[model samples]
Target: MRGGVRVERQLRRLRWKLTAMFTAVTVGCLLTLAAVTATLDRRAEERALDADLSTRTAAVALTACFDPAVGRITVDDDSADSLVLGRPYLVVVVDWSRDPAGAVVYPARAPLGPPDLGALRGLRPRVGPGDRPVLTDLAGPSGGWRAAVVAVPGEGPVNAGMVVLVGDPAPVREANAELTRRLLTGCVVLAQLAAVGGYWLARFSMRPVVQALTRQEQFLAEAAHELRTPLAALLLVARGGLAHPARRVDAMRDTVRLADRLGHLVTSLLTRARLQAGTQRVDLVSMRLDQLVEQVVEDLPGADAVAVRAAPTVVAGDPDLLAQAVRNLTENALRHGRPAAGAAPVEVTVRDGLVEVRDHGPGPHRVGHGSAGTGIGLSIVRWVAELHGGEFMLVEAPDGGALATLRLPGAAARPTRA
Candidate 1:
């Protein structure tokens, strides 16, 4: 089974350190916001609970009525029944008073609700003029009572007496508490969402850096190949020159040419190294780009084969580097393509600050267009173009050959946008 099946594995595509940090920070902020919201909501709810308790307590105490016809104190059943039919309570004491032995229940009173009315003595609350009510936490066999006590007011002396206590279950408080729990849960969920979003955003934001790195690796590989080829050729030619009789002018001229070629190679290396090290200083100036191309065409390898097709196009830039890049392109085509290859008589055209090196040689159709010359020639051209913030394009010519085009902004061009 192992041998038959393809081992399918996925690699991590994101920078873990950056993504994790973004997630953590976002989640941390979300959690803090959630906690603050929960806290504020709970505080508002607590204030709400306090307000509700006041209203409810006042409603329960409204049962007091003065029986002026009998000159006695009593509770209005209609008012009390209005509270409930079998109203749930911890304890409801109809009569109570404070004494040395603590609160004692009056014998003539009635009791209702559960047996949790044990602590109905301490809840001091003002009910009316010189009359008070008490609310207590009562202990019980099963649970407890959050009780309220109030005095029944009388119009005359009819022994209408003091206390009336009532209580409800503790679960109402639990309901209020549950509201806070739900809010906290929502806050936690929001925090998790923020963490996930932040991670993806962090990864997306830094994608450019990853792309730059991948391209740099490819460029280094190509650069190594380019440098190796020229050095190899120079070494072979130098050894041959040393072994042969190089006393004649033609032989001396060949040696001089070899040294000059090597010098150009070294200069290219320095240009790249300086740019990489941030030591390359840009010298932007207003100049006629068309004139620059014409001058460069004059110095091209096998200058006789290069023909000017149009007038000069001007732009502002470092003229020397731009000229060198054009020269490199011409040299590459001349050195590689021969008389019979139909690549003869290279064409130079300039318009709108754009330079084109067109050849009638065997076209790039023989090799893929994407190949940046598996050699050093095109590398030097691209490096110079990129150094000046210019653009390059290589394409097969209509006449069974190839063309290299370079475009750069001149002094007359608009400023770069940030």
Candidate 2:
């Protein structure tokens, strides 16, 4: 018999494997999706901020006027006020035509006060044509700013120039951070759900294995219980034979019978195991039920004490297995029927694919007392009958004894059922 601890360990291993697999796959997919979404969202936020900066720069560039002869340029106050309202950061116009490069032109003076202008001066050197906006990060005494410069044609002093627009990126950063937090929470929840689902799936899948193991345990336990009685009987008979040499022959016969019973019990267990494993193949062919019944009665230990009235009954089944079933039923009747002198003989009837063994004695419970052979034999007979899509019954006979019956699928000496 397999140890219970081994079985439990095997089940636990399978469950953990399933849980890990589920969590890895499910969490992997969620994290991948979250990463992709975050990338796309960051790009989108940057694009929208760039679009806002480009719109403000275009408005300033369109309104500004420059005179070539006077070496002067002018920009609209309304445009500068619109850029600063509901927004943070400072703007300055820069001239690329200067000999040193990155020379402030329109804002020739700082309007936002003399905070560190180095960050703004650095950005002017990188400006190009207004076809695409040039962006950079600027940090000064006022705080951080996301700045973009777009070059535009000027009338005179500032011939090639750019309108710079700057804004704080705190809101966009907050939105991205919030999305990341939510996605992480979703990943944790999905992992929990996967763990729960995977555990139940493992348990459901293991049910068949657990049942098979349990059945094997029961088979070993029951076999040991059943074999004890016959083994004890055989030992007693051997001891008696040695003590009384005059009755040694009779004692030896009893010992042989007990040995035979023990062999039958073991064979029954092995056969059941083979059947359950599907290793024992049944050869179903056309055969006579009565012939098998008569053979069983003849082979029974106390055949002379039983009477059989069998008709020509045909059936479709494995001939060997059917014979075994009949033999088991006969043994059950002889061992447990408890017939007295002059009592009606144990009657076996076979007709129309049905076989019945009846004894004229009290019912099974009274007659089956102290007999380990009682239940196993009947169980085998019932199993055999059902294997061929037939039925077996154990009920009270008309003579007040137990009646065992088998109904197979065929007519008497006729073609078998399809």
Candidate 3:
């Protein structure tokens, strides 16, 4: 029991290992998805900000006018009011006509400090008459900002003035920050869900292994119990022979019989273990089912108790394992088939791709009866039938006995023995 528990605990740890592997894979995929999403979002935000700054700079340039009389650039009253209402923008117009061009701050209603004007001078504007507006990024004390510098039109050989418009990118930055937080939160939830799903998947995958292991442990315990009886009898017979010299021969005979039974039990255990472990190589050959059944019946301990009604059915199977299956079924019938008074012997039938053993026993009550190693014997027979791509069934006979059937696929044409 302790050994079985240890094996089960070890298997449980394997389940966790499988779960951890599954979860790690899921998390990796999710992390990749999150990274791609964040990168795309950042690019999109940058594009939108660039477009916004260009549009606003065009608006400022369109509204500015150069007065050659004053040699200064000025905005109309409406444009001046609108520009002042817009927040987080610095508009400056520099007069190229002046030596070291004089810079004029737009939206005069709103004050532009020395530092803001000083930052605008660092943003070089096009001084040529027809140069296109230049868009660039500017880093400030607060954060990053986008700027568009355009040459202002004037009646002069050289450009009379230059318009510089700068826009703060705080809104886009705030939106991207919010999106990142939400994406991370969603990833966390998805990771938790993946962990849960992985745990269940691991448990589901291990269910078959657990069942097979449980059956193996049960088989070992039953084999030990079966061996104990013959071993105890041998010990008793040996002790008697030593204590009583006159009846030593009788005790020796009993001991030999007990030892023989022990040998049979050991052989059966080994055969069953090999079959269950799928290590038994079945050399299938062309054989007649009736001949095999007759041979197995003749060797049975209670051979007289079995009546054979076999037809000539040719099949492809390992004759040795097939014979073993038949022997186990006969032994099972002899042990459990309790006939009524004058009832016919236990019947063994071979026909229609089926080998059936019917006994006048207590019908369905005989099923699951582990007494005298019946369960393991039937188990071997069942496994043999399945190995040949067939089936084994135990049903209540119509005449109130137990009916055990081993069905194998019949050959299309009988072939010569290989």
Candidate 4:
């Protein structure tokens, strides 16, 4: 995989993350709203049920005669026959020994056929006016019902009187069920729209960062081309100077010096290009960490205080990039460590998985401390460290200067493998 090309499988980016977050929150809100509304509807239904029970209690209470010996519930039969309850109502009077389902001695057929007596068996047998009504969710085959069963006048103690009851649920509850369904559907549609909006929000929010990266890419291409022109010019001037070195000794020296400086600049640019384009992967071979560090220190302009700790504490990594990282750190330390009185020598230490660069200059000026190498060196250090599953940190040096550390990962550098 190329270095700059970071492939995110989906959830790694902000758009999907926002969409998922909004969806979760929306579902939760809708479910809670549905639950609260359902509970309230049930409470209201009970109030309606109590009102129905009061009317039934009044009618049953006033009736004068129901004696077992007489075998008849005496009443104003003409008025009872003419009575009509607002909703579906059934008033059946079973024969003393008739099977509840087999024969309806006087089935009230005005409503939905004989009351679907399966409901009659379930009614409360003795509920007077003040008794709390027990309500439930089952509605009889007639679509709605609230029945109260009064005992027969004969069974005085246990089931003392005949059962008298009513039918149907309150109108409000029936309507509530339909209302809730409509609300939930509306919420689902709104949530889907919210998720789509969240995705676009994330996309537009990230536009500036994308634009900055594009500009950097373009700048690098132009800069590399510009540097090549000077490098070629210096090389040509060196060739002319070399052809007449006896007479142009000074010119020859200047030409070679310019060529060297140009060559160094070209290398740094290429490293940046390779890293940015995402195509720099290095093959590892057995090598000595102690030797590599020593070589980097030797190659530096100043290595007086460079020190190696532990035997070659090697690891698998891109040796070229690693060497470059160390050199950059050394140069950075030298550049920033020029003190009022020339600063003490910078120190380099390698131990465990870490390479520490410590200087005794008066730390960084406030301008540079924020991200440590808003410049080139720290950036390269940070990238190389993480690419190897390690890290880089800039800390206050115990003495005076800043401490830059690169902690890397890999097997310990050792002797050549068999």
Residue lDDT tens for model 1, 239-283: 676777564445556667666766666666666556555687768
Q: Model 4 — which ten-residue stretch has the worst lDDT? A: 409-418
TM-scores, all models, native as reference? 0.67, 0.75, 0.79, 0.44
Q: Which model, 2 or 4, shows the larger TM-score? A: 2
- Model 4: residues >4 Å from true position, as ranges? 1-71, 74-84, 89-109, 118-140, 143-146, 150-158, 169-174, 222-226, 234-418
lDDT of residue 19 for candidate 3: 88
Clashes of each: 12, 0, 0, 13
Q: What are the candidates' C-alpha RMSDs?
A: 7.6, 5.7, 5.4, 12.7
What are the per-residue Cα lDDT tens digits for candidate 4 across 1-418?
A: 2323553333236658876787778778877888788778777776766566546534643452455686545554444444434554444443334466642322245564456555555453333333333433335565665655444443444333343445556465667787788778877887787778767766677666565566475545456554665566666776777787674777666676666555555565566667766687766555566677778988765466454454567677778988878877776776566343453466677766567777666675542543222255566777677767777878776556777888776533431110
Ranked by lDDT, the better of candidates 2 and 3 is: 3
Cα-based lDDT at residue 206, candidate 1 = 64
lDDT, candidate 4, at 26: 72
Please identify model 3 stretches exceeding 4 Å from their true place: 55-90, 96-115, 125-133, 139-142, 151-161, 245-256, 281-286, 302-304, 338-345, 360-370, 396-401, 409-418
lDDT of each structure? 0.56, 0.73, 0.75, 0.59
RMSD of 2: 5.7
Runs of candidate 2 exceeding 4 Å displacement: 1-40, 43-92, 95-116, 135-145, 154-159, 309-314, 340-345, 365-369, 408-418
